[model samples]
Target: MRAVPTLAGGFPDISEMTVARQVHWQRWLAAAAILVVLAAIGRAFVNGQIEWTYVSRFLTAKVILEGITNTMVMAVLAMALGIVLGVVVAIMRLSSNPVLTSVAAGYTWLFRGTPLILQLLLWFNLALVFPTIGIPGLWSVRAVDVMTPFLSALLGLGINQGAYTSEVMRAGMLSVDVGQYEAAQAIGMGRLRALRRIILPQAMRVVIPPLGNEFIGMVKATSLASVIQYPELLHNAENIYYANSRVIELLIVAGSWYLLVVSILTPLQMLLERRFARGALQITR
Candidate 1:
């Protein structure tokens, strides 16, 4: 019988690596021991130390679910705005006009310069600055009165998201080949038309994966909005915890909901990644 050759990094098609049966057994044993310890802890806390009566009756499922829903809504709205504004900023930065470039640069620099929490507070209190954000002799509305904590949080998160996403988009745009741009121009497309029709199509392939990461980051960032009285997940959890005084319970509920959301988004991100990477790996040779 011939001995199989082992390759480094990964198993080769023609060679079989030696399987560490002992190592596998040891790992299983270790995992079992950890599970046993966890089971022991669960058994100890099931009826003895954990004050089950208070947790069971006080931790209302409805409130926790509402918090989860609010969190998703905030994430969706903020990311939608962020992506739209980020695309505009990326385009502006790539534009021929100096004014557009400066405006886009200033926006990215200013927002990215400040902390997200500070930005949130700034939006929450924006009404204080202008009182009415409107053009003269045109439609006007009370800023503070109309922009509640919820709207403030949405705007803050979205705009801040735009500032960061703009850089990601700009980087992705730069990654595109100069040849593609030339080809678009050669096809009798105007600069704007070429950018919209050709550049953006290819740029998105690069932008999407990192953008998914930003979406995940935004999910966690929404928790900060609770400070401004936005009824997002953490705020909702706080309300429940404050009412029943079950701080840990409410926190666990909020964390679990966050885990669920991120878990769901994980698959979606992978799908998008696969879609974008489809033709990238194709080799003409």
Candidate 2:
């Protein structure tokens, strides 16, 4: 067979049309394959040969509301105490005194070194250290009564979170240019004022994103309080499941509430971060 060649003004001969068609078909086939796989997965979930009913039932109004309340309380309390402790530690770390610096370092080392679970357990059983804890001349409370699961969990989680947060804050403080400190001093700003007015404000930009992440983490970590019988989100869910023996359902309940809480918190954190970033970034058309 003679191969036909196109001349000027004549229809040009096209070669490899089959190759282009093959490429197009290959793309179509790939898309079809993906769609088929997706459809099968959706079918499996919808038919719930997977038992989604139990999960749905577990996400009742009462369960969800309670979980949210408990979770929020735990996260907020932990963050509140942690932040205050963190600031103090950051200050100590930045101080000129060697003893305070060593003390701050030791605190971070001890708490961050140990697992939080162990710390919680220790606090829960703290009465063993001293059956009574109070001032000798002042009013007192029994260690056994005062160190209830709730208090133990709070103290353990808050203190441990504080230790970790301290390091994060310290790093942020240190990251500020040393010249900022000198400039503040040159302006006759006292140490505390320089830190609060000048250095800390700048450090907040670096500190906040990680701090948000830490808050989110604390929400999950509150679940660990379950071991001590502290009635946080997961513990309450567990208690419900045990009573009703709807293990998977109650877990789904807990999971749903957690997802909702985190979802809300993430957007708020983003807003705060944007606010903090003001003047640090520029806008474009």
**Pairs of residues at least 3 apart in sequence or in different chains that clash in candidate 1:** none
What is candidate 2's local distance difference test score? 0.87
Q: Which ranges of candidate 1 are over 4 A from the true structure?
A: 1-60, 282-285
Query: What is the per-residue lDDT of model 2 for residues 131-175, given as tens digits with 9 covering 90 to 100?
Result: 889988887878999999878888999999999899889998998
Off by over 4 Å in 2: 1-51, 61-64, 282-285
| TM values, all candidates | 0.80, 0.82
lDDT of 1 by residue, 75-163 (tens): 98999999989989998998889999999999999999999999999888887898997887988988978789889989999999999
Quote the lDDT for 106 in model 1: 99
